[model samples]
Target: MTASARPWVLALGLLTALRLVAAMMLPPAPDEAYYWIWGRALALSYYDHPPMVALWTAAGSGLLGDTALGLRLLGPLSVAVASVLLARAGNALFPASGAGYWAAALLNGTLLFSAGSVLMTPDTPLLVFWCAALWAWVQAHLRQDGRWWLVFGVLAGCALLSKYTAAFLGLGVLIWMIAAPRARHWFRDWRLWAGGILAVVVFSPVLVWNAQHDWVSLVKQGGRAGSVGTGSALRYLGELIGGQIGLATPIIFVLCVAGIAVACRRFWRGDAAAGLLAAATIPAALVFLWQSTGSRVQGNWPAILYPSACLAAAGYLSPRWHRWRRWGISVGLVLTAMVLLQAALAPLPLPRRSDPTLARLGGWQDFANRVEELRLERGASFVAAEEYGLASELALHLPRGTPVIALGDRWDLFNLPEPPPGGRGLLIRSTRRGEAEPLWPQSEPAGEVSRRREGIEAERYRIYNVTVIGDGPRKVALPSRR
Candidate 1:
């Protein structure tokens, strides 16, 4: 590596090492455990997301076993690669002002990316492939080479496999091609059409999987588009903006907004690079902004916009903004470090409801152990929960070969083994977020367990002794032993 590249590599390597340590230190969140179960099953797609996260988890755990480090191994590694690719893309897009290194640093410093790097989730793979696609597109535009389009296509396909939200990226690219005068000529390029075809071809597995499953996955995710807010639209919009500010960190969010405004001005002045960045971000930003006016938009839903947005922010030329950029990174890193520490060790004396890390990641192992003791005492054949997250967590922490059943309709979509008819099991129901009723007719309160982290109770669950009286349609299922 060149002398200049060495610092970037070393810095990224150190950050990755710290993330891996955090991954190993903290227990898997319920969502992480759910995705880990997906990895165990290895489906073409899933009821919630496409198969990329499953594939990534499977690869990580296959090599490192079912440990937290194993399941989350790729998250940090992928983010490191993403940071490098984003740096290159920034440099290629704006050569002056060292926007490349600043982009990389700014991205790493963000709470969304920093905290996300240690968690095995759909967003993990999506962010990496998103950066890769941006890099490929930048190379293609700068070199005016059609071959890079093919690379962009593959990365775009991978991003789609990671999450359905990736469709917006493709939409943004189309807008750029149509709106930017310099890029309009690509409409006549055969390779451009070929690249589009290649993306669809690569995404065919998900289509086939959905086709076989009655397009259930597509229907489920697509339904979110039609949801309207029950409360005032302004309330939801405020929440959405507040969430982004907190997730991005206030100073960084300010930088991004300022940079986007600058890019918008340059775009109308016929600057192709600025237009490309603006086009890539505006479509998704507007969609989410509109969605917030109707329904609650997830803070992370706009994650795809950050690669180009950060690049734009890094490229913004202003003495005052440059000073703010430095402070932004410093403050962001401090906030990120605090979150990591809180997740790993609940040092702060916050209430369980107030501390998100405690609510999601705390006390799972202890909770599983207590549930297992109850199961054995009741002579139950399997353990069951009405929630998928609870069931998946039980599956991860319960003894090997223990049958953990998710008593829900979604479990029917999985290829796991059906629960035995006329069997007895322990049913767990959370008092805080209970959604489903008991499936079995014969159920009685057996015990109650409180999930606690650092002496603070996060949740309370009631355990029931349930005996299946008949082979009803609501019967749960369990995965076969690996």
Candidate 2:
């Protein structure tokens, strides 16, 4: 191997191994368990996200065992893959002053990647391939190699299969092809056409799934960034800013903003590489900014931009800005260290209001154990949870070979076949915003139980005895999310 490649390769390998250990130690987040459910019922895709997370979870579970560690093994490893890809992409684009290491280090320090690594959500798969696409673009465009175009096509398509946010990659590609004289020729190139076709082929499964399901998934996701009613827009924007600032950290965020400004200037000055990176990232970030003005946007909605944004930042963060760069890296490292220590040792004790991680991931195992006892004592043949997140947690933490089904949403479409139809099952409904109000109005309330963490009620479930209808027990229609 080349001298330069060795350090990166070694660092990445060690980081991957350490992250894998953390993945094994930490409890599965609610979303992780929910996706685990998707993995077991493997489909082309799902109602919420594409099939990539499900595919990863299924592979990890198969390779390991059906445990928390097994289900989440890929989550942290994906971070390492993304970091390595970011390093390579940075080198390909900036190619100065160890840009590769700086870019990877900067990205790793971002909470978006660090916390995301253990979460095992849709973002993990999206990030790994997003970096791949970024590197391939740099290789294909900046290096003037046609072969990497095909690789970019595959990775970009895979990014889409991971989440719909990848459409922004296409938008950037379109803008670059239109705005950059050097990129314009690609419109007539056979390689470009071939790459486009390949992307469509890779994404065909999602399209086919939508066709079969009346395009429900597409419609649901498409409408998400619309208006957030009237007064909620400012509140939503504030939340979005706070979330992004937290995830990226203030120093790195400032660097990214400055980098984008510098890239815009350089692109107008006929710098093709700068234009490529800016066009590929800026539009996606702006979309989130604009969406935040109208609707509540998730913090990670624009994460696809970071892979290129980090490299863009590396382009201008040079010896001239050494003090600023050092400060950013130093503060970022401290933040990262604190987060890693918390994950590795234990979460800090805080009030339930301030401790979402504790309130959510902490009490689930105990909650499952108590509910299992309730099922046995009440002679309930099966267990059911009101939401996919709750259902997935119960299914994962409950006794092995047990079935915990989701009671609402399109869950009727994927609920596990545990006690079969007509069986008397114990339904677990939380007291969230009066959730138990209309729960099983037709059935009798058999008993109730509480799940607590540090003497605070993390979750409370009212158990009801209900016969599984032929179609499954009736549940109130879940409110439309979008």
Per-prediction TM-score to the true structure, in the order listed: 0.97, 0.92
- Stretches of candidate 2 above 4 Å error? 1-10, 340-347, 415-419, 439-441, 454-456, 470-482
**Local error of candidate 1 at residue 256 (angstroms):** 1.0
Tell me the TM-score of model 2: 0.92
Q: Please report, in order, the local distance difference test score of every candidate based on alpha carbons.
A: 0.86, 0.75
lDDT (tens digit, per residue) of candidate 1 on 1-482: 66766887898899899999999999999998899989988888888999999999899998888889989999999899899999999888877657888888888878889888899999999999999998999998999999998998999999999999989878988999988999999989988888888888888899999999999999988888778979789998999899989998998888888788899899888988898888878998998888888899988888887778888899965776788888998899899889989988889978876889888988898888888888887789888887889888898898888888776677777887666677788889898666455665667887688888878888999888877655444655655224
**Candidate 1 residue pairs that clash:** none
Once fitted onto the true fold, the runs of candidate 1 whose alpha carbons sit more than 4 angstroms away are 433-437, 469-473, 480-482
Residue lDDT tens for model 2, 244-291: 888888887777777777888888988888898899888887888888
lDDT of model number 2 = 0.75
lDDT of 2 at 471: 54
